[model samples]
Target chain A: MSAKKLLVGIFDDDHTLIHAIEHIRHDGYKVGEVFTPFPVHGLEHALGLRPTKLHTAGFMFGATGTTFALSFITWVSTLSYPNNFGGKPFFSLPSWIPITFEMTVLFAAWGMTLSFYYLCKLYPGKQPKIVDPRTTDHLFSMTFDLDGKDEAYIEKLSSLLKAQGAIEVYIKEL
Target chain B: MSHFESPLREPLITGNKTWKKITDDIVVNTTGDIKPLWLIATLISAAVAAFGVFCIGWEVCYGIGTWGANKTVGWAWDITNFVWWIGIGHAGTLISAILLLFRQKWRTGVNRAAEAMTIFAVVCAGLFPVFHMGRVWDAFFIFPLPNTRGPLWQNFNSPLLWDVFAISTYFSVSLLFWYTGLVPDFGTIRDQAKPGSIRWKIYNVLSFGWVGEAKHWERWESLSLILAGLSTPLVLSVHTIVSFDFATSIVPGWHTTILPPYFVAGAIFSGFAMVLTLMLVARKVMNLEDYITIAHVESMNKILLLTGSMVGTAYLTELFVAWYSGSMYEQYAFANRALGPLAWSYWTMMFCNLIFPQFFWSKKLRRSIAFTFFTSIVVNIGMWFERFVIIVTSLYRDYLPSSWIDYRPTWVEVGIYVGTGGIFMTLFLLFSRFFPVVAIAEVKSILKISGDQARAEQWDEVKDDDVYKTLEK
Candidate 1:
C-alpha cells in the first residue's frame, strides 16, 4: 500500500464530531474514518457505515456447537460403547440438554469474539494506527484521505471543519 | 446529540463528571501509585491464600482422608463451599448480561467489578470438586477424552459430567465477556499512560490495540450484545446443572423437581449479596462514591429483596411439598432438617437468607450503606448454610437409621475453605489495584444521558411536551 496524506479534525464533544461528519460528507468530500473515546450514538450512521454482521457469525457458530455436541454425545453413548445407565435408553436426550446448551453458548461467544478481533485486525501487542492520542481520552477525531487532493482543496476542507466546530485541524502522512 | 430520558429518573452518575474526569478518577486506580491500605489488604489476603494453599497440598499428599467426610456424609464442607462460591458468581453475569439486555442503565456502575467477582468466585468454587476427587492427578478422568484404560468414557447421563461442562463453559464465557468490556477502558488508560513506559506497554497489549474507531466500536457493541445474549441463559443453566447434581439423586430431600429454580434464585441472591459486600467496601476505599452512588445500592438491594423473596418462597414450598406429598421418607427428611440435631444450621439459613434481607423492604434500610453491608454478609453466610442444610442434613440422616451419624469439617477442610476466601480477595484486590475497577468507557457513554450535571444543564433544552409533540408527529 502507498503512503497517503490525511486531513484530521479533532473535536471536544461527540455531538460536534457527529455534526462535522455530516457536513463533511454533505460537501462530497469522502470521509475516511472517525475515532472517539467512547461509542457515540448516531455517529456510525453519520459516517454512512453499514451495521455489523457479527451476530450472524455468532448464530452460525452456535449452530455448529449444537450439532457437534448432540452428535458426539449420541455417538459416545450408543455406537462407541453403550452401558446400561439406570436402565435408561442409550440416547438420553434430556440428560444431554445441559451440555448441548452450554456448548452452544460457549461456541457462539468465543467464536464471535475471535471473529470480531480478526475483522478489526486487533490482537495483543499490535500497534494501533492512531491519528490523535486524545481520541482515546477526551477528544473525537475524523480523518479524510487527501492522497490526490490539491492544497486549495485541503484548505477548503480545513475551513469547513473549523466552521463545523472542530477544536483542531491538521494534516499528517500515514 | 440529544436523547429523551424521563425527568423523574434519577441520575445514574452523580456529581459533575466529564469524560476527562471519568478517565482520571477510574484510571488513576490502576496507573497511579498503589495505596498503602490496598497493600496492607493484599498482604493479609495473600497470607490467608497461602495457608489455604498449604491445606490443599496437605489434602493432596495425605489423600482425601484429611477431610472430615466419613461413611455417612461423603460430602460436607467441601461441596457446601463449592455450591456457595458458584452461587456467588451468578450476580456478575446477571448484572452484565441480563441487566444490559433489559437496558437497566444502573448496571454500568457495578457490572465490571461484579463480572470480575464472577470469574474469581468460579475459580474458588472449582477447587472443591477437583480436590474432592482425592487423586487430583487423575482428575482428567472426569473428561471423556480417549485414554489407555479401556477407553472408558464418562457417562453422558450423569449430572456430574454435565456440571463439568456447565462450569467450564461458564468460566470461559464470563472471562471473554469481562475482558471484551475491559478492552476500551484499557485503551483509555493506555492513552493516559506515558508513551513507551511499562504501564503503557502492558495496557496496550491488554487493550488488544483498540483505537476506539467508529467501526470498531460498532462491532464491539454488536459483540457485547451477542455475548450478553449467550451469557443470560448460560448463567441460568450453570446453577440449573448444579441443582441437577442433587435433584437427579434419589435422596428424599435431594430428589425434588423444585431444585433447579430454587438453586438459580438462591445463587442470584447470594451472588448479589457478595457483589454488594465487595462494592460497598470498594467504593468507600477507592473514593468512588460519585460513580457507585446510593441509587445503585438501592437498585441492588431491590434485587436482593426480589431474589430473597424467591428463595424464601422456595424454602416454604420445599416444606409444604415434603408434607403434602405424604411420602414418609420425604416427610421425615423435612422434619429432621427443622427439628433434628442440625436444626440450628437450618434456622440460621432461614434467618440469614430469608428474614435478614426482608429489612430491605424498608426503603431507608435498603439505601443505608451500613445496613446493606451488614445484610450482604449475613445473606452470604445464610447462603452457605442453605447448601450446608441441603447437603449434610439430607445425607447425614437418610432412610437408614443404622448409618445415621453427625458430620463435622476437620481443620484441614476449614483451612481450605478459608483459603479460597483468601484467594478470592487476593485476586479481587490485585484486580482493583491494577485494572480499572469501573468500566470507564461505559460510564462515559452514559454520562451525557444519565449524568447529574448533564441533566441539570439540559433541563430547559427540551420540554416533555416537545418530546410528546415529536412522538405525535
Candidate 2:
C-alpha cells in the first residue's frame, strides 16, 4: 500500500561498499547516490560517475604559466633593457629555469585545486552531509536511496543489509 | 577473534598531570623526571646561542672581516654556515615529502620537530647572508631593483642570485606547509588549555576556523598532497642551486656538473643523520619512545645508508673524472683533497660518510638502538667534514702556484658553528615544549586505520572509533 519502494544493503568493508555499486545496479535497482566519509578507490566507476577532466586543464594552465613566466622574463631582460654582467649573454635560458619551473608547478597545483573545488562545488562554510563523524578520523560508508514501493521487499532488503555485516541500521530519510 | 596488539611503545612520561601540574613540576624541580645532565647541556647551548647572536651583530656592524675571511677566501665561514643550515633544513622536507610519498606513517611523529628545524635553519642561514654583505643595511643589493643602480638587476647568470631565489622560495613554501599542518594541532592545544591562558588565546587565533569538520579533512588531504608535491621540487631546487654556486664556476674543485645531484644527496644524507641524532636524544629525554619508535630510527638509518652510498659514489666519480679530464689542476685538486692541509678532515669525512654506512648493511647494527644512535651522530660529524673538505681543500690549492696559501678557520668561525648547534637545539626545545611535537591528528588517523575489521566492515571510516574512545577516554 506504500507509494515508496526501499532498498537496503551493507558491505564487508569500504572497499566492498565501493565495489557494491555495480552489483546493486546489476540487480535492477537505481543507485541514486553512493556516500563515503573517506575516499575508496573505484567508487566513481561503481556509481557510473564521469571521469574528472581537471588534470588536462591543469596541464594547459601550467603551460600557459610557463609561457607567461618565460615571456615576461624575456621582456624584462632582452626587450626592456639588456645589461651584460660578467661577460655572459643576456636573456639566459638556464638562468630563467628556477622562476619558470617554480611558476609552472605553482600554476599547475593552484589551477588544479581551484578547478577541482569549483567543479565539485566545494566552498568554505558549506556544511557537508555526514553519515558518521568517525569517517574523518577512521570510518567509511556507502549509502543509496531507498524510496518508493513494497513493504515485504523492504524487510527482505533490510535483512540482507544486516547479513552483509552492518553493525547498526537506521531508517534514515533525507 | 584474537585481539590485535599495539606496536607502539610507552611515552617516557605518562600520567594524569594537568598543564599546571607539569609547569609547576618543571619550575619547582619537584620531579626529577628529566635528567639534570641534559638540562645543563641545553642551557649551555642557549648561552652559546646568545653569544653567537652578539658576535653576528658585531660582524654586521664591522663587516665579515670580523672573522678570518680574505680576498682569496672571499666566502669563508659565512658561506659555510649557509650551506650547513640549508643542508640541515632538508630533513623536514624529506620527512614530509619523500616519506609521505612512500606512505611511511612513521613520519607523523617526527615531522613537526623536523619542520621546526627547517624554519630555525632558514633563520640561521638568513643571518649569515645579511652580515656577509658588509653594509648589512644595503643587503637589498641582492634583489633586482628598479633604480638601485643604472639598470641594476640581480644576475640571472650568477649562481648567487639563483641561491637567493632558491632559498627564499624554499623558506616561503616551507613556512606555508608547516603552518598549514599546524593549524589543527593548534586546535587540539586550544581545547586542552585552561580558560584565560595566553596559550589558549594564541592557539585560538592560529587555528583559523578549524572546526575539525569532516569535509575540511578531505580538503586538508588535497591541500597537503599539493603542498608535498610543490615542496618536493622546492626542496630539490634549493640544494641544487647551492651546488650551482660551486658548479658553474671554472674553479678546479668547484666546477662539476655532478655537483647538483651530489649536493642534493649529501644534503638529504646529512639532514637525516642530524634528525636521527637529535631525535634519539630527544626521545630518551622527552620519554617519547612510543611516539617515535625504533622503526623510525631504522628508517632514517636506511636513508642515511642510501644517501651515504650515493655521496661515496659521487666522491669516486669526482676522482675518476679528475683523472680522466687530463687536466693537471683537477688532478691536483683531488690529490690535495686527500693529502693536503686538511687531509685529516677529508679522511674523517670519508670514514664517516663512506665506511660507517656499510655497517648499516648489517641488520644487527641498524636495529641496535645504541649503535644506530651513535652512528647517526658520527654520520653528522662526517657530513660536516665533507663540507669542510669541499670548501677548504679546493680553495687552499689555487691556480697560481705562489697564491696557494693554507688557511685555517678561526676560533670565531668554530665558535659560531658550534653556537648554531645551540641555536638549533634551543629552537627545537622551544618548539617541542610549546607545540605538539607529533602530528596528533595524523597519528590518530594512522592508528585508527591500522586495525579493526569491524569498523572497516561496517563504517566506511578507515579507523576504529572504539579504539579511539578507549585510548583518549
Candidate 3:
C-alpha cells in the first residue's frame, strides 16, 4: 500500500510550510502529511487536524492505575493476608498514599508512551518512509497521495507549492 | 515571538547557531574518537567503580559486620548514602520534567545532561539500599510478588515497601521520560550520520524510525506534556516517600511533619548542585560554552539559592518546633546536630548550604563560572551532610542513654560511597560520548523563538546581519 507514488513539497521554512498547507487545502486537494524538524505552532489547525485523543487515553490509564492501586492495597491488606504492623490499621490509608501515587504516575507514563508508539505506528527496527532526510534536519515537507489526482491538478499543486516558497518538489514511492 | 521572549530570556543555545550548526556541534561528540580527557576520566571512574564492587563483594562475604553500623546507629552510612544518592537524582527530573512543563526554554540546553545524570544517580542510589540488606541475594523479597515462603506477603503497611515501589517507579518513569525526549534528538543524529554506517544504523533503531512528521510531533508533544505532568508529581512523591521512611519512625529527629517538604526541597537543592557540577565540567570539556552559556549557569544558581534558603528555613522550623514543643528528645536531636560530636558536619552543612548560597544574591557571583562551580561542589557536600545529620545524629542517641554510640564508617562503606561516585561519573562520561548531550531538536525549535530574533533586535539593527558575530566571546 505504501508503494503508491507520493508528491512531496519541500519548504525552506515553517512559515512557508504553513502558507502552503493553507494554500493546498484551499485549492481543494487532499493534504496528506507534512513533516518538519520541529512542531511548527498552529500547523495542526492549518492542516485542519482534529485534536489528538491521546490525553484522553492518558487520563483513562491514570484513572485505572489509581483504582488498581487502591484495590490491590485494600485486598491484600484486608482480604488476602491482614498482617498488622506498628498497631496501625491494616487498611492504613496514609501509608497507602505513596504507593497509590507512584502507581498512578507509573501507569500513566508507560500507558501514554505505549499509546504514542501505537498511534504513530512506531516500533523498533521499523523502516521509516522518509521523503527526504533533510525533513528531520531543517526542511519542512508536505506529502500528497498522487494515486487518484489528475496530472494537471498535480502540476497546479506543484506550482502553488513553489509560489508559497517551496525550496524543491519531488515525486517518490515508499 | 512570545511576550516572554526578551533579553532577560537567555539565549539557550548561544552562538546564534543555525539548525545545521546545532546538529553539527552536538553530533560531533557522538561521532568523534574518544578524547584523551574523556578516556582518562572514564578510566578513573571505572576503576573506582570496580574497587567499589570489590568492597561490596568483601562486605557480602564478611557480612554487614564489615560496616561500622552498630545496634544504636543501625543505618549510619548505608541508608544515608541511599538517601543522598536519591536526593542527587532529583535535579534531572526537575530540570527535564518540571522545567518542560513550565515551558522554561533555558532547560533545552541542559536537560539532556541533567536527565542522564538522573538515570545514573538513581542507579547509584538503588545500589546502596540493596547492598545494605545483609542478604543481598534475597533483595527480590522487597517486592510483593508471591514466593515459596508460606503466606509471607510483603507488608503493604511498611514505608520501606512503599520506598521499594516508589524508587522503582521513579526510576522506570524517569528512564522513559528521558528516552522519550531523546528520540527526536537521536533522529536528528541519525539523519546526519553517513548513510549505511554503524552510527546511522544504531541511531536509526534508537530513534524508532522517527521522521518528524507533523502528526508525530503533535503526538510527541502530547506525550512529553503528559510525561512531564506525571513526572512532576512523581519526583515529589519519590522524595516524600524517602522522608516517610524516616518520618514514620518514632526516632526523635526523624518523626517531624516537616521532614517531607524538607527532604523534597533538599533533594532539589542537591540535585541542582550535582547538575551544575556536571554541567560546568561538561560545558568546559565538551567545548559547549556557547550552548551552555553563563546565563544558564546563573539561572541554575538562582534555583540553588532559592532551594538553599528553603532548606535553611526547614532547618530553623524543625529546631523551632523542637524547642517550642519542649520535647527533650527532639531538642537533644536538634541540639546534638549542632553542638554534638558531629558539630563540624553540622556547621559545614550550614555554611555550605545557607551561607555559601547567600553569595548568589549578588548577580555577579551568580554569573561567575568559577564561583558557580565552587558553590555547586560545596552545596552537594552540604546536602550529603544534611542527610548524615538527619540519619546519624538522630540514631546516635535514642531514648536509652546507655545504648548511645558514635558511628564511623568502615573503609568498605567509604569505598562503596566513592564507588557510587565512580559509577555515576563512568556512566555519565559514557553517556556524553554516545548520546546527543545537547538536545538538538529542542534547541532548534527555540532557535528562532529565543536565540535569533531577540539577539537580532538587541544588537544588530540590520535584519540581515548574522547574529553569530555579536555572540563573539
DockQ of all predictions against the true structure, Cα-based: 0.85, 0.09, 0.79
All candidates: interface RMSD = 0.9, 6.8, 1.1
Assign candidate 3 its CAPRI class: medium
Q: Model 3, range B1-473, lDDT digits (tens) per residue?
A: 33344353456666768877887888888876778988998999999999999999999999999999999899988898999899999999999989998888899899989999999999999999999898999998888787678766877777899999999999999999889889888888889987788888899999998989888899898898889999998899899989999998999988989989999999999999999999999898888987889988988999999999999999888889999989898898889999988899899988988888999999999999998989999998999898888889889887999988888899999999999999999999899999999888888888876775556565444433455346443
Worst 10 residues of 2 chain B by lDDT: B22-31
lDDT minimum window of 10 residues, candidate 3 chain B: B1-10
What are the runs in model 3 whose C-alpha is more than 4 Å off? B1-4, B458-473
Q: Give per-residue CA lDDT, model 2, range B1-473, as digits (tens).
A: 22233423322123333223322322222122555675687688799898887776666666566678665666666677788788889999989977787777678778877888888888787777777777878888886667735665555667787787678767776776787677666655554555357755666666553445323445556667766877788789889989988988888988989999999999998888878878888777666665677667777889989999999999999999999999999999999888877789899999999988989998778778889878888887887778778877778667888777767667666666777778987887767666667666665544333323322333334136677547645
Q: Can you tell me which runs of candidate 1 are displaced by over 4 Å?
A: A1-3, B458-473
Candidate 3, TM-score vs. the true structure? 0.96
**Interface RMSD for candidate number 3?**
1.1
lDDT of 3 at A61: 92
**What C-alpha lDDT, on a 0 to 100 scale, does residue B200 get in candidate 1?**
86
Docking quality of model 1: it rates as: high
Clashing pairs in 3: none
